[model samples]
Target: MSNHEGTKGNLLAFLPLIVFVVLFIGSGMLTNDFSTMPLNVAILIASAIALLMNRKETFSKKVDVFTKSAGHPNIILMAVIFILAGAFAGVAKGMGAVESTVNLGLSLLPANLLMVGLFVIGCFISISMGTSMGTIVALAPIGVGIAGQTEIPVALAMATIVGGAMFGDNLSMISDTTIAAVRTQHTKMKDKFKVNFLIVLPAALITLVILGVLTRGNAVELAGDYPYDWVKILPYLGVLVAALAGTHVLVVLVGGTIFAGVIGLLDGSYQMSSLLQATAEGIMTMEDLAIVSILIGGIIGIIQYNGGIDYLLRMITRNIKSKKGAEFGIAGLVSAADIATANNTIAIIITGPLAKSIADEYGVDPRKSASLLDTFAGCWQGILPYGAQLLAAAGLAAISPVSIMLYSFYPVLMGICCVIAILIGYPKFKRTDDASASISK
Candidate 1:
């Protein structure tokens, strides 16, 4: 084949991804409900399609390719981390840790600043616990309660909680999105956090001000006292502190799980058998996501082997001549993936390799690239009506997801902040090559 023909043929490798997006989005739009089309099913069909293409390879050879990629060391390591994180979250929640943490934050709120309090508390809890869903589930009802008692809008309050959740989800060390980003880019979690934090801090502060002004004089009358046990808050605090101190992620997760489980046992909140059960349930919750990660690895492996990635990189970077353009390209790519999938973590997983290639080619810092991937994904996921965070909050508040989406100020501002960062090259940091050369000197 001529070189031109070979390049064109490689472009066809993207066909499976195109088909998956069409089927997933098409079915969701037709049904007006995304739940009917399981993500795994769409991906499975796409995986089969990927295998079916590249006809020159024998069936057995293709299968071998799929299996090897599925079990790639990085993918396996990520899966194991997912399981550990699930176990830790499960055990902590089972011991009433979430409730205690929520209550502790609520107990400190000034009556008139109920809205602001929810946002701040959501940030703290989500950052500590490393799951926006958990934070939303714990805070959304309180937001609803505050709305009922004051002139605050339910949608506004719910949006505040979600905005806060996204803030922490973007920065949290133990978050799966963070894990995927850091692992894929081969950067440290703490390093990524530093980059991500500087980019989003202004947005978070601005959102806080907006929430404060919006809820000013909307004093909430207490219906009941929020009770909390200090002991139940220890695990989350420990985990957060250790993560910030630059401890290895695996050690933080395993130690956090054991600490939470031991506390539960000592407090009579869990029997020994119940601790084991909670651990199992948590691991089970992450099974679907872990499997999806492996599947994506396999599919992407095939596509890359077929030169789809090279073709894609060529097209995307063909006109990019500067580092800022490269950063924007990475941001746009991940944001698009998030929009198509409606899941930030999955979007990061899918876009990570592509983003890494771009970063390496353009001399973009890994930390900056990781930050862009996580921040952009969170920005879109925060406001998507079909996204889990908004949906959960809307359902709990008994309002439309669009209503909450309209008021998700933090996410909107977060995206803008990211853009500004890229435009001006904010939070300047040493790239890997620069650091290595300095050390060698």
Candidate 2:
């Protein structure tokens, strides 16, 4: 294809992404019920519009493009993962996993240490599960409940959850963002983890200490009514163990669901029909996220077709001159895409290839580049009030997403650490001779 044709194609690919943001984010702002405006409807509309925008293609060809993008293996895989996650979360809750886990956590910690403990738990769960959304879903309600009893600011409580969730999301080896970053950058999961851990570990520790200090004097009486402690905590443990074993997210979730079902049945808390009902409810609960994911996927596909990503890449990399500039370029590439898409994984996916190219051109290490993509995209996603993590955290805590942003210390710290790493070149890798030759050439 001619350069012009290629550019046009890329531009066409990005149109759906623009529409999704405008519709979903804009409508959420206007309506004040982020949950009320269905994300799938927005995606369906954007997909249709994308299909229509292919003026030169035959109807069948347009259908083919839509199918190709929508049914891409990655998209299908994510959908499957989503289903399993939903089912697992639902079943686990029904089986009393959330409450059990909460009780277990509460049982172990002194009241003055509750806030830091929740943050630490949130981090551990997210890191193990590789999903901040899952962590928030499992813990935010508990955090809220704690708040009601402890007189803690709901925003602070929610922020604790959010901070911990982001910590895991940024560092988890099994996380989708981690997977995407590793695959895109052509780096080993272990290598990426090594670099990412160094950057985020300090931030997490500092945040924990700060939280401990802040909540040291706010002890409250613990509630004591729930009795499913051991069994309830089992589901979360099952999921976490499966995830840490490198089981596929779907399998891990299925394992969690089965565990929840069996435990619930043995305990007589739920019948067979109730298990099914819980599964259905879990699936139903993902309605908004499902819609948002589909729409974001289709929109991003359209944006890719339109060369919008390329345009941004060219614009951002136009003036790269130094290591710091190259790092800034990497950060900007992912951050801009994230801002446009409101999905960190998608942003990394879109920017990965170009980022690789930029890294090669500017003599940046692939490991560093990979870390930058995940870190910066995560930073933006964690802070965005409208993004999924914050939204879920906010929704579960019954607080404004904006409020959570103000207290999101970990994400902010991660960003600062990334910048410092780039400037000081800590954890630097020796570049391959061939890569060095390419950069010089």
Compared with the true structure, all predictions reach lDDT values of 0.78, 0.74
Which regions in candidate 1 have their CA more than 4 angstroms from the true location? Answer: 1-9, 110-201, 209-221, 320-412, 420-441
Cα lDDT of candidate 2 equals 0.74
Each prediction's number of clashing residue pairs: 0, 19
Question: What TM-scores do the predictions have?
Answer: 0.65, 0.79
User: How well does candidate 2 match the true structure in TM-score terms?
Assistant: 0.79
In model 1, how large is the Cα lDDT of residue 372?
Answer: 95
Runs in model 2 deviating more than 4 A are 1-4, 8-19, 22-63, 128-162, 172-194, 213-219, 223-228, 341-346, 384-407, 423-441
Clashing pairs in 1: none
Best by lDDT: 1
Expressed as tens digits, the lDDT of each residue in 46-145 for candidate 1 is: 8999899877878887788778877877667656666676787778889988777756655777766777778887898778767777667556655765
Q: Write the per-residue lDDT of candidate 2 for residues 1-441, one digit (tens) a residue.
A: 122345423544566656755776678788876555555676677777777775655767656555666566665655555556567777876776767666665677787788888898888888887887667766665687667667678888888888888888888888989999888888777777778888777788888888888787787666775344776777777766766666666677677788889989999989999989999987766555545555555545555554566677777888898877888899998998887667788889888988888887887777778999999999999888657677666544555566677788888888888888777776756556543221210
For model 2, what is the error of residue 356's alpha carbon versus the real structure, in angstroms, after optimal superposition? 3.5
